[model samples]
Target: MKISTFISTLALTLLMLIPFNSNAQEFPDLDKSPMDAAAFPSKYDEPKKLIKIIYSRPQLKGRSIWDLAPVGKVWRTGANEAAELTIYTPMLFGDTKIEPGTYTFFMIPGKQEWTAIISKDLNVWGSYFYNEENDVAKVAVPVKNDKNNSIEAFSIVFQETSKGTDMYLGWGHIRLAIPFHKL
Candidate 1:
């Protein structure tokens, strides 16, 4: 109501709108992995690249990862945040047809193999409320495990192929690969 009071309130509100200087004091986890995406050129002879996957990398830290991605379990794919697959064009992701958009990535880990999933749901966390019906595709990824060869962290990457790309997941001495073809 008063002029002085109104000016004081406006000044306070403006200060709050300014960016906080908290970045210096805030500490970050050294163990926290970074988010990365793997993109490849399209097979249609297009100049631009397509088929991108964004995911976080989680280290094993000598802990058993099988507990989270145990046999017959529906895996969230990685840690922290759910993995995301973004395509610039329509393509078959793990045998499931998907249009140009982003998708949630999940998995079903088995002793012999792993099934990668492209889900219609977005921003899912830790496989919570994972619906089989929401999946766009559940394609089997060939798996190979070596006791001597240990992978330190969970990773999602792709290898160039004539048709499209061969997506690979490597973690804890285990590696799985699946195909994604551009239509």
Candidate 2:
């Protein structure tokens, strides 16, 4: 009887541990889409200061709009949710100060310097349908090729600095960086 009880407790503990493992096997039917705010408990509630950007598959993996993207080509810079890029704190891009808000991110990829554009319009596909007049800010950043092709998932991360913050976008063999100061 003791052996059976021990086995039962062990099984229960293993079952409880599954959800916490990031690499745990997931069932095929389980949906991984972003959940609504109410789905999380009150303890998880906190005002999100950071803007969330989501880039999904197909849109991200296929031919990227760089070098091969054609200089004048309009590209849908990111995926669902309008390829949203957020500024958590006030920042200055180039000589322009950008207030904290969400903006639709777009880029004009070039062999030398890439033009990064943020627009007030946040709902749309690739820049195939872009409007230059909608742009709120535009900054030029240089792109450097990496010897080792490292990044598989296209992503951007912001790092804080004494002056302000550095916005880094990593993908393919390139890393594009933009420095901003507090507005």
Write down the lDDT of every candidate, Cα atoms only. Answer: 0.80, 0.63
Residue 144 error, candidate 2, Å: 0.9
- For candidate 2, the per-residue lDDT at 153 reads 52
**Per-residue lDDT over 18-49 for candidate 1, one digit per residue giving the tens place of the 0 to 100 score:** 99876668677774777766667534434576
**Model 2 misplaced regions, further than 4 Å:** 1-52, 57-68
- Sliding window of 10 residues with minimal summed lDDT for model 2: 34-43
On TM-score, the leading prediction is 1
Structural similarity to truth (TM-score) of each candidate: 0.77, 0.64
Between which residue pairs do clashes occur in model 2?
Answer: 75-127, 76-126, 76-127
Best by lDDT: 1
Predicted candidate 2 versus true structure: per-residue lDDT over 1-183, tens digit per residue: 699999999999999977776768866762232212110112233363433344432223456545434675554453334466666667677877778887777777777878888788876766667889998888889988886875755556666677766767776777888777765
Off by over 4 Å in 1: 1-27, 42-47, 146-148
